[model samples]
Target chain A: MTRGFPVGEFQARLARAQDKLANRELAALLLTTEPEIRYFTGFLTRFWESPSRPWFLVVPAQGKPIAVIPSIGAALMAQTWVEDIRTWRAPNPTDDGASLLSDTLNEVAGNGQIGIPSGPETYVRVPQADWQRIKAATKGDIQSDGGITATLRAVKSSAEIEKIATACDIAGRAFARVPEIASEGISLAQVFRNFQGLLLDEGADWVPYLAGGAGPDGYADVISPATERPLADGDVLMLDTGAVFDGYFCDFDRNFAVRTASATARDAQARLIDAVDRAADIARPGTTALELFHAMDRVVTGGAGGSDSGRLGHGLGMQLTEGLSLIPNDHTELQPGMVITLEPGIETGPGRMMVHEENIVITEHGCRFLSPRAGAELEVMR
Target chain B: MTRGFPVGEFQARLARAQDKLANRELAALLLTTEPEIRYFTGFLTRFWESPSRPWFLVVPAQGKPIAVIPSIGAALMAQTWVEDIRTWRAPNPTDDGASLLSDTLNEVAGNGQIGIPSGPETYVRVPQADWQRIKAATKGDIQSDGGITATLRAVKSSAEIEKIATACDIAGRAFARVPEIASEGISLAQVFRNFQGLLLDEGADWVPYLAGGAGPDGYADVISPATERPLADGDVLMLDTGAVFDGYFCDFDRNFAVRTASATARDAQARLIDAVDRAADIARPGTTALELFHAMDRVVTGGAGGSDSGRLGHGLGMQLTEGLSLIPNDHTELQPGMVITLEPGIETGPGRMMVHEENIVITEHGCRFLSPRAGAELEVMR
Candidate 1:
């Protein structure tokens, strides 16, 4: 597969952003986060792991996005469609691209509204001090982009959907190999480590997110890191991974019993997959995310709200979780290109819960699973 | 190795922060970033990869830190020493813990000044909309933490140092096995993918950052993601990684020649190691980060100045790159227990460059390399 998007893909994305800008009468969008900058310019790099320097991309009203970044990134940014790349010797105790970014904003927009993605799940990815400096120096009114950024990114292109599907396939293959590394007496931490290795071996570029739990009947919560607790007979093991393939993530999980599967655990497993199916069946264009959540909530919680985890699942793509959430309040209509995770958690006991997730894309016909669909029966590991 | 820190380690950290809070007369510190929250509470998890929910930790002047986070994190937070854990059903379209966090802050700090880290390399990790709402609702005077957060984090404890050293050791082992995964005909992207697998085998909890390049003589830049370009016989390859172990990061890189090394690349490699050695020779409790930079710069760039990576290296611990930076302007004095990476870059030829990095920790006497030190000679791949 190609490393990054084609030039036309970026051009189409920019045209879409420009359309939003024209409609809103906004001058430009000042993007600071990785996904935002990358969505417009195809400037993908793992260097964002370092919080040392802040990178900025300004999408003007009617032109290609301009990159104002650390000088270290000039070469990589040059390879992308972003031509107006401004560089600075970063960790520059004084300015650190704040002035250059503000100047670029003024030059692009000039006394108009320079929008920034400022709704939920959108952070101004700059130093708090530097953000203040950039805001003070800018001639334009720096305000929230009014969901324009989120709206543009919510829907996925065909190419983006393919990448996400490929990621799901890679994770599916990795999940198939879990029994090789997991069994009774194997520590959960080792299973997690081996599962990540399996992801790399199965064509994942990297595994960004991996969290699960193993306990009798069910696990406590889905967000905790793997502990050294060894697997035992009748204990359930959950391995959720957000493995990436070309910057796209497949967020899903698989459950297995160590040696023997309990009737209650098996039933919960069946119900979890039923929830995913229930949600996917009605997840069509014009359907709301809240409705999908209700479909899953009905199966998992028996129409009793949901687990304390809040949302059942969420929008997924460039990030493990993004865009609209599968919550009661989120009324975002499902779009043809929108990809989401149907993650439903069910309480098996007083404090034990089982959560299952699957990746799917909303299509003209209906919702189609990107991930290899899981069966109701829980596999017992040797 | 232990999964999380002991209660005493967290207690000591809280005591240190309380001292800083008392001295500054700041009512409390509102921390949003992973490292900041993890430092005081021993609450470590890779769940922060998801941007769906906001997590907050309020460090009051006295008493245990209060955690105002999503209900999903309640179980994990309970595992830590933190007692006052407040939860909100997150993705709550109206308020994702904004009111709860502000209320917690007000209860802890009263109407006094609440601090948030605002200096260089410090970002307010909350979403922009939620941050504004929290600021608007808080009765306390919200402002920059002055430098209290940075000051407290710069100096590490014995346990923190040990974890960092362990991470360095894991990376060192992974680097040693590069020959097993890399060779003249293999693509750089494959090498990157395999190297991450090696890191997991070498005992890293996760490989968060891995960026490198392979080109004839030397790579153009160090921050670019690996391309599909195959490594040629005359290529010089560098693999930089920020591998984590128990939440501590070891930020370092190693250089390798594919089959054979060019004289220019060999010389650059030698100079980079010499620069690291020079920096370590004077990196003691009394030495400043500026002095260390000058030492390394004298050897790498002959005092002509460093590359665009900004600083040659910076402080390292809970995060990949954090706290003080090694630049001419940074005058922060080194203290015992301060972990840092001594990285130096040089122009091998016109547009080509090479960089080498080694993790080190300042001691009462001098700097000691935490990462298994690389020799002056570049290892040629088979």
Candidate 2:
């Protein structure tokens, strides 16, 4: 595996986006976030961890995308398929590529309707002061892209699916070795640390997001950082990881019974896996996200719906969570190439719950699992 | 050792920001980014890796800050020092905490001047459409915070400095063990993956940013990702990392020679370290950032100026690179408790440069090195 997609992959993405832009009557689509930029130009770098510089990619109605980036990144951008690369001495207080970006927007868009991805789950990465200046200088009318990019990004190509499958394969190998470092005596914090090491050893590029918890029944929530509390007997330990390989992510988790298991946890784990398979059974080309949500909700919650964490599963690829979400209100129609997670949560006790998640891609007739599926019975830790 | 600061630390930070807000006549300060929200409150989590939800924090003129966040984060936010935490079931496309945040802003600011950190190096994290709606719903006047929070954040607290020093210690140990993983015949990409594992093994909570290069005399750029090229004799391998421990960052790099060394690479290595030490000599309570840039720039470039990476060094703490930049144009004055990196780059050949970086803190008298100072001569890998 390598860092970026092939030249044809980006070109195919551009064609799909251009068709959508034309139908919406938008001249160009402006991208400010990392995944959005990388989706168009195949520009990948970990330097985005620093919020010091803002990068821009403008995809016109016809042609390759133009990159208005810092001078330090010109060499890397050259390696991509993008031809017209503009540079600036960045960290410039006066104009940090603002006017340059505005000029590029004017040249490509030409007073037409220029769109930015400003719908749900998206935010413009530029500063307000600079955004105001760029808006005034650009000849195009800047507004929302009406979810064009999000819709196009939800349907994965064969290469994109392959990258995501590679990421899933890496996480699957890491999860199989969890019992080696996680036992009754180790602390949850140490387990989290050692688990991350296992993911890297199994060939993950980086573990960007890792959150799990351990308790008698289940974890309180899914998003909290690890604590130093020691894992005790009868504890139900859950480890959820969004490990990346080749800039694609695999979002899934595994459950373990530390030194023991209760009847409630055993039943809950089995029900969670059953709910996931039930959802997969109805996951076809024309099914809506709401239908999948209800299929799993019936088994997990007795049709009561999800808990406070909101959605059960979400689309994952370049990010841990993206695009369509599985909830009662989300009615996004599933497509052939749409990759998503089927996560089902069961309330084991009063305030504790156990959640099971697996990655899958919807095929023409049904769906297939990307992650190595766990058994119905929870693994027992020594 | 812990995920967050003490209550006193957050209280002291709020008090300082309140004092500054009073001086500027701003009724309230709005914080949207992760670091800004975490600075005022000890709410730390790796959940920020997912851009699914937007979080907001409002600090009033006199009282504690108010959190308008998703219900998924309410439990974690409650553990912080904050008292007023407002929650809404998130991923709600209809509302998504916008109306609640606007109402909170209305109650606290109330048609008064509501300040947001919108100066250089700052960005508004909310979507433009949502921001417009929030702006219309609020009665307060919204504009820039006039660098109030940035100024306060630049000067670290005693607890903050201790966390950064611990992170530096972990990176120092990781760099010392590089020869075990990196040597002649080993690929650069393998070195990157194994080096990150070493950082984690040495107690780094996470390694967010890692970039370097290997070439005959020097590398072309410092920010590009690693390639598959194996190290050879006379290659100067540079590895820079911004590893984190308890949310504090240590930004520095180490250089090593593969098997054999040339006179040019050896001389450039010593000169780069000399440039770093020269800048540290004048780093005191009253010196300006420009003065530090000149001291290092003189030694590296012979008064010609720094390379296109923009600055010799920058402020690092919560974020990989933040706050002040050591450039000729940046005239921000250094003060006690200000932590920065002294990084100087020297061009050894055409389009090739080798840079040296060291983390330091300015005391009341002078500056002290936080990262272990590297030897004047480059280390030789077996």
Candidate 3:
């Protein structure tokens, strides 16, 4: 079986999903996105890159989840815990997967309501035309199930936490070798390539998201792709990576000075680290995401530097960024088994900024670090 | 500017889009997907990895596109050709860019209809709830614009083709060095890591998709991730990659024999190459995807072997797979300035198969190779 986790893990997940569906008085849950489908069946494949086809998974209120996917994925799905696998030759303009998906949903739900994720941070992977066709064919009310699914997915399993921790360790090992590959005179683009290579060499299944910037005092933004400009003395270089291991992601970054550091950059880095420490100290089973945001914002701004970045941090798991964002409006309560990132950013100058991030798993009393703790001061590369 | 292409390229694209919208009587076209937004405004950023916020671009019938996105992306979007960039602090539960996007659409569209891609191979990137909110708040009717957008994106510009060719060349260079990294004693997982590192070293901006399978005679599937199984003598290994260069992707793969090859595998490889050659010879501006599929299918099946793989080939450009698929049901005509991939898979045994792929750009007279041609014989790694 190519699926990474044991059958019990997927079974527990399905059970949780079914419980949520039952609690919401829904007959079944329709999952079309990659993360939702992979969560219940453990049917993992990189084939999702090709958008030519859409895969569907329907979880009933009482039984095991059924896979309604293309025939190309049958062999892999069979290796998972799913038993009732229905498939069709995909890219069929006449039928596609619409008929099969509709029939499957109708069989499970009959005339009852079917839940699907449709709220914030959720996207329906199936084409809108296909979704309309399915809706017209099936006799069921397709209600928004984002609240139910997000509540369940927010809590991670032990196996998932271990996988995330392993990914963090791999990234840490790669970041430790950045000094050997990055130095003055090396282009930031080349540095990105070398750093990504090091991440893969250290044991990441793949490096999906890598974005950073390099500037004299600090970077203007943290999301821009590396430019070909050569690194110079006194430049602050930041590299953030979302490396994967067994489908789990570790979202974090490390900062380094090319030859020397400005006092403003140093002070910003220290303040960001302090903010993370304060956030980590208050991250417990009962604190809300908004509360945690306030806890970090105090140290980051000190009533001066307001954050322009959307959120301070977010929940992390199957996707690079997941539920329960650390913003003022989000009231999602932190609970045990929830893995999240504490990312605090500070503005150093008019067009310069520094951001610090770390991954942690919330426990009964507090939180434990998944990623290795970064140093109090910024490290020098040359 | 951080935007990749010149203003003239984007202006041309906008002109094409406006012509399509005007012909369809659409007051404005709404784009939310990464590829769609980047295609129009050249607003390229890796921040799309985070799904916390939604980014929107609204193109009027006769003018430039307006961007209503997160404030965090204002700097990068400013670097693009888009002049009217509206900003908001994102991950805001109360109004997550909905009001801004709705207001922008209303300003341009009035009470007329707005177009959005809603057909096959198209996914709405925004949350369904937010989309509903926008539809309720705006005065325009949101209708399907997939046919228009797909038609515009199907044909590539000269600069786009060159980027894809460069990415292909980088992959070819990396594949040529496989013998030095892959051997009988090495695990397939390590081989994948080394191959991706080589692609980066060869100037590929990033490798988005790398999938393959290793078996005695041939692999059962082509989309499976590399396992830790050590390669033995007489095993056939296939590696397919989607490497990127300037947001353009090269989609192709290569097959290699570990030490010695089986007769069936060798014959299948030769036949696959022959199929590609036949398809390439017949490819021209007037041909159709169905014709190309038949051209390759005849060489692979020989009126005997039936194919289960959905499509023989698909269009490729900004995405790993896009636009028209070389399937019997699709009748999209090949046109000048269109780039596509010719992929043929042959079943060597009951459950084992080998597939070959190459990228080409359709020219005025005939098709020109964008990816370097593969050899008739399968390469041996020993």
Candidate 4:
């Protein structure tokens, strides 16, 4: 119970999930991933880092969630709003809570279909053998929830938005100090370490993801860990972070030029900013993710844009990245209270690219920035 | 790419995995988890943070692994020893690398059995729907590997052991500086942040898991994130971290007494140290994990010990925690080159507990400490 919102907030989320389940005529929804389980009940713990045990939460179509977890988590899960908790000693290869899960699902489903997430970006955390065992033991028709829970998790609540915004502000403060910490002759690895310390000092609960690269014009890839390569003049250093605050993440990055920048890098940075602005104008309730992607693409390529960096951006909350990716094929309708990142990347040269990202919350009219806007000119760290 | 061992290291690992597959008559091993994939090909990247895409590496019976991953990861994976990399635009709901994975598997296996991890402490990281689709597309017998890969991954090479030792040393240096960073009037959250900063400054690539608690006698649980509670006299504060170095983890914790310690707390600390000593004496190549557990249990409760913290310790490596739990039911025989943590816990009073942990590498004769041994008495911070 490190971070607990008002019980009413959890109740509202549970109601939303139950409504979705009812519409699908599903008897229950079985959640296994961290974000989905934490969405309904406030059972938060870093113990999920240990994959040794599987924790399960079953949301009945009508009532509250039932937690079938290891006894070690019983004390922590008891702190949550969940009441019906069944515990067992975990790491038990013979059973490993499968019987308890089956018994609980049987009691909850009552011959109706059970919905589990099996679609895009979702994985069943339970062991495959145990999942099969539980399926054989239970009597209900276990079917894919068709990403119902992910669709619900896409829209952030006010509290979640506040947490994510706080994370963004923390990372923003750290980014503002990049010039002082990153300089010539300092290895990129040392710079990465110093920046992570700054993020922690600025109030990030944890820095889960920090990836960047440094090169002459621009970096080759944005998802690389730092190397011992020292920063030199005319190098463009980009640092992207997914810093967490109270379990919510702000996915954004800032680029800094070592002493100087090339014209291509500066132009790419400006174009990325312009693309974000264009996307922001259309990022209102009822807009589809595809529409937002096209808006940004038009600005990035002067109406000839196509995909770069695989995805422009994606939904952000609870985890570093969540559902409703801002890609062309994703037609997820944006609504008020949905938090996302407007990230636009452009190729500066043949194998060199620059990416700019900003976190935002979709509003009734358009969008508001969570992370402070990057400068039009690339930051120079001399 | 960031931390590449000799290419022969990866070759040796692939050879071992292939040997395991051959023993089980599995034509190919499909790895989807971070540690497993990184183990065979040295394809290390923090891009695993985004669950949006599934990365697969197929280790055939007699050759190098084939990486069927998102196109965005192509550049980074190219840096690794992996050669045959197939890429696709991921998040493509129409396919999402399923067809590509099927084609690769079909090409590699050719009606032979494909092994996937499906036993305890393992989960398929791919989308359940996509896995089903791939299963339907491919003609191979996709069977549960039954912990085949995990067992192979449990034994570390000398190079791997060096990385773990380096991570342990980094955490040890940070723990040694705790007196300067944590004390009375500083909130536990601040202490967590400062200590994580210290870990980075010391040389940890990233600190993925840092959890602890402070209480009058001892903390109720050790898996909680830091809260805003301030340290005061007579409180026992503990910090456990899983800091990573070159993708290997050192899982250990240190205890500090604020100003003074109660007799109960002091006694509990002594018992935990004594239990660790007894367990260390028996932590050799031939002893089973259960026997090691019993050795520590005998000292903790005079032959009547029961569970206090779910597990005493577990296997530590690429992930925060892994296979081979030090529990009574786990009879996984300790072998030379296996690295594990010797964690001993005792209940000082109702709703209060203290646990001590250290990392070790099992050797041919006995075991050697990967982390500096904790002090005989809990360090007091004023």
What i-RMS does every model get? 1.0, 1.2, 1.2, 1.3
lDDT values, one for every candidate: 0.89, 0.90, 0.88, 0.88
Complex DockQ per candidate: 0.81, 0.72, 0.74, 0.75
What is candidate 1's lDDT per residue for B1-382, written digit by digit as tens? 6567778988887888788888889999999989888888888899999998888999889888889889989998998888899999988998788888887887888899998998877888777787888889999888888878788888888888889989999999999999999998899989999999999998888999998889988888887778788889989989999999988899999999999998988988889889888888889998999998999999977797666777888998888888888899988889998999898888888888888999898888987889999999988987
What shift in Å separates residue B343 of candidate 1 from its native position after superposition? 0.7
After superposition, candidate 3 runs with Cα above 4 Å error: A1-3, B1-3, B304-306
Give the range of the ten consecutive residues with the poorest summed lDDT in model 1 chain B.
Answer: B301-310
Encode model 1's per-residue lDDT on A66-160: one tens digit a residue. 89998889988899888899999988888888999998888899999988998988888888888889999999899888888899889999999
Per-residue lDDT of B212 in model 2: 94
Q: Write the per-residue lDDT of candidate 3 for residues A253-322, one digit (tens) a residue.
A: 9999998987887888888889899999899999999888888888988744246687899999998999
Evaluated against the true structure, the overall lDDT of model 1 is 0.89
lDDT of 2 by residue, B196-267 (tens): 889988988778889999999899988777888999988999999999898899999999999887899899
2 or 4: which has the higher DockQ? 4
How far off is model 1, as Cα RMSD?
Answer: 1.2
Cα deviation at B324, candidate 3, in Å, is 0.9
Candidate 2's chain A scores what TM-score? 0.98
Indicate which candidate wins on DockQ.
1
Model 2, span A1-382: residue lDDT tens: 6557779999899999999999989999999999999899988889888888889999999998999998888988898999999988788878989999999999899989999998876888887788889999999899999988888889998888998999899999989999999998899888888888888888887888888999997888888878889999999999999998878999999999998989989999999999998999999999999899999999988999777888888899889999888988988999999999998888888768899999999999999999999999988887
> Which residue pairs clash in candidate 1?
none
The digit string of per-residue lDDT tens for model 4 on B1-382 reads 2366999898777777777788899999998888888888887888898988888989898778999989898898899888899999877878889999999999999999999999877888988888899999998988898677888889999988999999999999999999988888889999999999999999999999998989888988887767898999999999999999988999999999999988888888888999999889989988998898888888776777458366677998988888799888888888999999999888878888888999999999999999999976878887
RMSD to native, candidate 4: 1.5
Compose the digit string of candidate 4's lDDT tens values, residues A1-382: 2366999998988898888898899999998888888888887777788888988999999888999989988888888899999999877767898999999999999799999999888899988889899999999999999778887888888888889889999999999999878999999999999999999999998898999999988898887778999999999999999998888899999888999888888888888999999898888998998888889888776655455456788898988888877778888888899999998888778898888999999888889999998878888887
